[model samples]
Target: MRILIVHNLLWAHYKSSVFQALQHLVDQQADLSVQVLQIARNERSRAGLETSGGETPPTYTYNYELLFDRYLEETSVRERTRLLLQRARAYRPDVINLTGYYDPAQLLLLIWAKINGIKVVMQNESTAADQQRGGWKERFKRWIFSQCDGFFCFGSQAAKYVIQLGVPPAKVLLRKNAVDNNALRAVYERALPTRIQQQQALGLKPNNFVFVGRLIEAKNLPMLLTSFAEATKRSKNGDTWGIILLGEGDEQTKLIQTIHTLGLTEHVILLPGRPWFRVPEILALSNVLVLPSRSEPWGLVVNEAMACGLPVIVSERCGCAVDLVHHGQNGFVFDPDQATQLTQQLMQFMDSAVDMEQMGKAAKQFIAPYAPEVVAQEMLNGFIKITN
Candidate 1:
């Protein structure tokens, strides 16, 4: 079987990890082969996440062609459609896997593949709560979904969203997304011995709740600050804990002002953004990962933290919250609207009643099933099922 996968950004390290594992699988099976067409080098918003060498990270192990070595926004739809069609025709794949349906260029390719009797699979990450949905856009999504032969969704919420848009339940081929678990754990473990020294050098507290993402409005940073302040005030041992915001964004100035207003200047620390590979260093110094996003498709940082053996506190709106978080066991999930609930959960973490080490072990165990090799195998199985 020949599979052609179309992806948007070549700089996406997480997807590259899965593709690498998929290529390893293909190498072992004489009948199976895979190729990828990367639409662009990276997205404009993610340009800062590039390696210091200003080159793609040395993580790719799969066969892929980078069609445009520029930001995604710089490429016009006509150029993308023309090149994608030309490549698809040349490759003549038995099955085509598309990243998502939002891109008009990819959607055009999907229609072409269907016309040519090639099986098509869509990898989806959006959930019902991702954004407001209704009107002609919904109808268009339904039509596009109807053309797909199979799906590989990020998690349960994503799978349900596709099914709600008129896809048959059986067509939901794979229901997981993954990161490089072994690599993340290795990095975290390597940094473990020096974690205290690193934290002291940065003037960070002994125990910290770390938030690892862009500092944008959607992340609800101001709300997180308010909740963290309240949690600290309510917990007697909260003085030993602190909150670390580890990413750069437009809200930095405002978040700093909010920290001052909340009288948490001493308890809150803001760090500059780091590359994807270096995130485990910060995770090594943190006790828990907190993602209080008002809107999140899937919080991959949660997966990274879990792989590093740290429990997470995620909001219900995040797509991974349902599948990754086990409330009161590994971590807790709360409604973003309920600031008091988040405060309570934070205080619970700092209190002596909760066994953080045990919770961390549970988190590691819970996230093991979402490893890159496992997801790649499942994706190959989905292809076999659909093409058969």
Candidate 2:
């Protein structure tokens, strides 16, 4: 069986990990083959995340054909659709996997696959609760999902949204997200001994609540700062822990101003985001991960933090919070709208009321099931079921 996977970017390290694992599975099966058609090298939004050591290297080894030599954001939609159709026709895949319904070009491909009698599976990251949904877009999404033979979703919330849109439960396979756990953990463990030194070098406290993502409004950076300030003041130990924001965006300047306004200059640190491989190094220095997004689809950083054995404090709005975060167990989930609840959760960690080490262990254990190998096997199983 020949499978064609359509993805938007070759620079997506997380997707590359799954694709590599899928390739490993295919290598063991003589009858199965997989090929990916990537729209471009990277997106305009993440151009800074791309490293330039002469040229950016492939994050994972897999059989993929990049349709355009550069990133797709600058490419013409008409040309992109034409090229995508040309590749799909040339590949002649028995099954095709489209990334999501938001892309009109890929929607065209999905329609073509249906007309050609090819099995189609879709991978979705969005959740109905992530934003206000109702209108022509919702109607269009339902119609698109109807054409799919099956689905691979980001998490339970994402899966629930798809089922609500009329997809049968049996047709949905994956309901989780993961990173290169072993690979990330290996680097993190190697840097464990020097974690303190690393933190001290950055003028950070021994313990930190780290937020790693784009510094945009949706991340609720202002709320994080407010809660962190309140948590620090309320702490009996007197501002014992620090907060770190790692990533860049338009809100960086505003976030800095807010930190100053809160008189948290020494308490909060803002670092620019690094490439995927280097993120584990930063995670090693922090005691816990914090994602306070007002709206997040899956938040892959949560998975990366869990793999590194750092307990997370995720916003309840995030899809991954539904599955990965177990309140007061592996990590805590706080309502992004309520600063007081977040402050209280942060206080628990600051006071050392909870055994962080035990929670960290629980985090690692919980995240193990969401590894790339497991997800790849599930993907393969879902494909087999659909094709059979």
Candidate 3:
């Protein structure tokens, strides 16, 4: 079996990890082969996160082909589309995995694969809750879903979305999203002993929650700030738990002003976005992970945090929250619009009565099966199911 996977970017840390595992798995098989066509090095918003700060070079690498080591935005739309079509035809794959329906190029390639009697698997992360459904878009999505032979989904929410689109339950495989769990755990554990010193050095609170993602309106930064301030007001030990916002975007100016207006400058610290590899160090210093996105397909930061043994506070809208967060067991899931609910959940984590260590351990244990290697096997199983 020869599988050709088309991915958006070479610098996508999560996808790269999964591809590495898939490649490794295929290597041990008798007649199995896997190859990837990385459309670009990075997207425009992600350019900063993709660059290497090291002097020598990247020590860690993915064993695959980078079709274009430049951002897609650097090239004309026509040129990029042409490149994908040309590459897919040349590769002559027995089976192909497309990025998603949103990509016209990949969708066209998926159609081509079907026409040529090659198996096609689609990657879907979108959940019904993440967006406003109904209209021509949902109908178009249903048509696309009907065409694919198999699906690899983010979680239960995503799987359900496809089943609603007329895809049989048996045709959908839920691998969930994953990070390089071992790598994150190693980075976090290595920094664990010096967490106190590191927090002090970084001028951060000893016990704080960490929010790592783009500072956009959809991320609900303003709402998070409002909720945080409310939580502080309700807490007797208000000085103990602070928050660290680690990412940059258009909403930075607004988020900063809101933080100051809310009188949270001393309590809430905002740091410029760092690359994926550097995130685990920040996670080590923090007590919990909070992803309060108003709309999110899947929150991969939740996976990274859980892997580092940090319980997460995720929005119920997030696709990963359904499968990964166990609602007060491993973490808490709150309605993003309800400020009081968020405040209550935050207080639950901040309370000294709560055994955060046990919750973190539960988080790590819950996330073990969502590793890249495990996801790779699920993908292989899906491919086999479709091919047979």
Candidate 4:
């Protein structure tokens, strides 16, 4: 069966789980031919420009900037519709999978696919309660979903939402976000030594906490910093722990100011973000990982941290919290906006080094079922069922 996958290419960074799963399916199913059609708005002009011992060109992926540009500048509704129709005619796919976001591309693609007699499957982000309201946007989304052969949701919450959106319960498929465990294991094995060496170079002691993700309001970095400050006040001399913030964003200057004003200059370290491959090493060197996001559909880094055997503290708003994190078991879950809860959780981890180690072991065990090959097969089976 020929399956044509359509999604914004920029999602490639965190969506490696999807790509890895697709590759796994291709490897296992001889009859399956997969084609990825990325409806990218603009190609990177700087992608292959430099080759010497020169500065590295900035890497671009699916992010706010790219998504904004795609929607605002490069393509319009009519042009995008035309492009999808063109691609569909050429590919002639048995099954067309549409990934959901606020973007119009997926919706347009689904509409065109329906008119052309192709089986369409839409994967969306709505969770139970949010599905009940069918505003104009929701109505349009519902129209697109109703015409599809199947609807795929990220979790039970999203599946419930799809049902609320007026989709038949049998049409909705629950597909959870997954990690590429074998690839993650390989990355962890390779990064462990490098992380230790880097820690020595940076003068960081063992058992420090690390936070990964963009420094945006949604990530709640300011709240985390404030909570860390409060946690430090209750600690002995504030020298017992260190915190590292990874990833860059528009809020860097404001976050820096908060660190300085809070007098946490000595404890907090800001490291520029590295590629996904370098993350396992960073997690291995840390005693714990914290993702204090105000709102997150899914926190992929939580799975990455768990794969590295590091305990995590994630916000309750994260979609992955339900499946990946178990409070007081693998990791703790705190209300994203509640600094006191975050501080309390931090103190709990800091209080006992033995407890931290045990939690880390539990985290690793918790994520063992989400190996890339396993999740990929599940996705492929879903695709097969839809197309057949």
Candidate 5:
């Protein structure tokens, strides 16, 4: 069996880990092979994450080709379609896994693969709650999904969204996402002893709830700030706890102003974004991970924090929330729009009633099955199912 995965970005360190696992799995199997087609070096929005200038390079164990050694935004649809089709024809894959349904170039490639009797497995990351569904767009998505042989969704919400779009439940082959679990755990373990020193050096509180992602409006940063302040007022030991907002985006200025207005300048700390690999360093100092995005397809940072044995507080809208978070156990999931609910959850963590260490252990256990190696095996099983 020959499999070709069409992925969008080379700068995706997490996806690289999964591909590495897939390549390892294929190596042990007879007559099985896997290759990847990376569309571009990175996207314009993710240029800061590129490890081109002396940073440690990511591990690339899979056989692959880079379609364009530049940002994807610079590539035109016609050129992408031409090159993608040209490459697919040359690779002669038995099965192809496309990244998503919205890309015109990939959709054309999907049509060509179906016409040639090659199996098509689509990877879906979008959920029904993440965005507004509509007239022609949903119809177009249904038509595209109908042409797929199988689907590898990011989580239960994503799978449900596809089934709602007219795809049979049996066609949903895999329902998980992954990150470099082993690597993240190793980093966190190594940094554990130095956690106090590092937090002191950065002038951070002893206990903190860390939010890792772009500081955009969709992240509901303003609401998070308000909830944090309210939680502080409700807690008896609020002086020992703080909230860290890590990552940079267009909403930084507004968030800073809101912090000052809420009289949370001392309690709310804003840190610039770091590459995904270095995120565990920040996680070492945090007691809990918080992602309050009003609309998140799949919050991968939640996975990273869980791998580091930190409980998460995720929004109910996140695709990963349903599968990963067990409310009152590993973490709590609350409506992003409800300030009171988030505040109460935060206050619970700030108080001594909840055992965060026990919850963190539960989080690590919950995220174990979503590791790269496990997810890679599940993906391979999906391929075998459709191919046989």
Candidate 6:
């Protein structure tokens, strides 16, 4: 089997699942050749083009920015179409996989593939309701869906959304984002050693709640800060509970200001965003993980936290909350936008450290089956069913 993956970039620190999936396919060694073609807005500098290993799969690049921003008015839609057609002819891919937000390139390639009797599959996170906002973009997306042989969605909600867009239910597949359980097991095994070093370095105590992910409106950081502040105030053991906010984004300055206004300087600690490799170290240092997002299609970090044997408090809106969390059994799920609910959930974990630990252990067991390799195999099975 030969597969071509079309995405926004070849490598991104946050998109580890994609890398794991592609790597799993290559590791199958079933006479499979996987090529990754990235359509990016920025050109990679000399320093940015280094490969991790010699046998990495996937190769192709089409700079959308070069066609739009660099050339100004020179490149036309017809020229863009011609370029993509040329690439399709050269690669002659058995199957083309599309990822990320919709792009003109995806539409063009899918249309061309349909005409050439080639298989095309689109994987995206957008819900059906999101496409109902009447506009040229919605119409364009509908047209794109018409050209694809199958659709891969992040969860059942997204699969339902895609089916609502006129694709047959049989053609829509649900594949959740997964954690690298092998890596997670290694991290958990070394947790004690890493935690000792992390505590020594950061001056963090044994009991602290950690929040990871981008600081943004969609993440509902303001509500989280407020809820944590309230939880600390209402706690019987004052100063016993500590909150660590990790990752950086557009909401950082505003969230910092809000933290100060609420007099939560001592209770909340802000850490700069670290690379993916260092996340396990951070997760190991904390007792509980919280993801308060207003609208999370799926919270991959929650799975990672659970895999590392930490209790998680995720928003009800998160897709992973539906499958991963069994309230009071593994972890808790609260209304992300509601300060009181969020505060109550956090207090539940903080009030009893022993119960939290037991739940954390349960969390690890809950998500053990949905490992990256297992998820990748499911994805391959889905692709084969759709193509056949």
Each prediction's whole-model lDDT (CA)? 0.93, 0.90, 0.85, 0.72, 0.92, 0.70
lDDT, residue 130, model 1: 82
Model 2 is weakest, by summed lDDT over 10 consecutive residues, at: 50-59
Task: Summarize candidate 4's per-residue lDDT along 123-233 as a digit string, tens digits.
Answer: 776554322355697787677667888876766667766787788887765457666655666777787777768887877755588998777777889888898888878
- Tens digit per residue, CA lDDT, model 3, 183-277: 88888889889999988888887789899999888999888889889888888877788999999999999888999899998889988887788
Quick one: best lDDT, which candidate?
1
Regions of model 6 farther than 4 Å from truth: 13-32, 40-84, 128-136, 194-197
True-structure lDDT of candidate 2: 0.90
Q: Write the per-residue lDDT of candidate 1 for residues 1-388, one digit (tens) a residue.
A: 9999999999899999999999999999999989999999999888878875564444768999999999999999999999999999999999999999989999999999999999999999999998998999999999999999999999999999999999999999998989898888988999999988998999999999999999999998888899999988889988999998999999999999999999998889999887788889899999999999989999999999999999899999999999999999999999999999999999988886689999999999999999999999999999999999
Ranking by lDDT: 1, 5, 2, 3, 4, 6
User: What lDDT tens digits, residue by residue, belong to model 5 across residues 1-388?
Assistant: 9999999998898899999999999999889999899999899887886652476955767888999999999999998899999999998999999999878999999999999999999999999999999899999999999999999999999999999999999999999999998898888899889999999998999999999999899999898889989888889989899889989999999999999999997788998887887788899999999999999999999999999999999999999999999999999999998999999999999996789989999999999999999999999999999999
Q: Model 4, which residues run further than 4 Å from truth? A: 10-17, 23-31, 41-79, 126-134, 194-197, 236-238
Candidate 3: pairs in clash: none
The candidate 3 region of ten consecutive residues with least summed lDDT is 54-63
- Report the CA-based lDDT of candidate 3 relative to the real structure: 0.85
Candidate 5 residue spans exceeding 4 A from truth: none
lDDT of 6 by residue, 1-388 (tens): 6666665543442344545565667666876666655444323331222332343423322221222332213445576566666766777877877774355656778877778777888886765432235678667767778778787777666776667667788777655667566665575567667676776578665578889887888888889888888888887754776778888778899988998998978667888775444577678778888888877777778878888888888888777777788888887888765789988888887677348768878988988766765666766766677667
Predict model 6's lDDT versus the native. 0.70
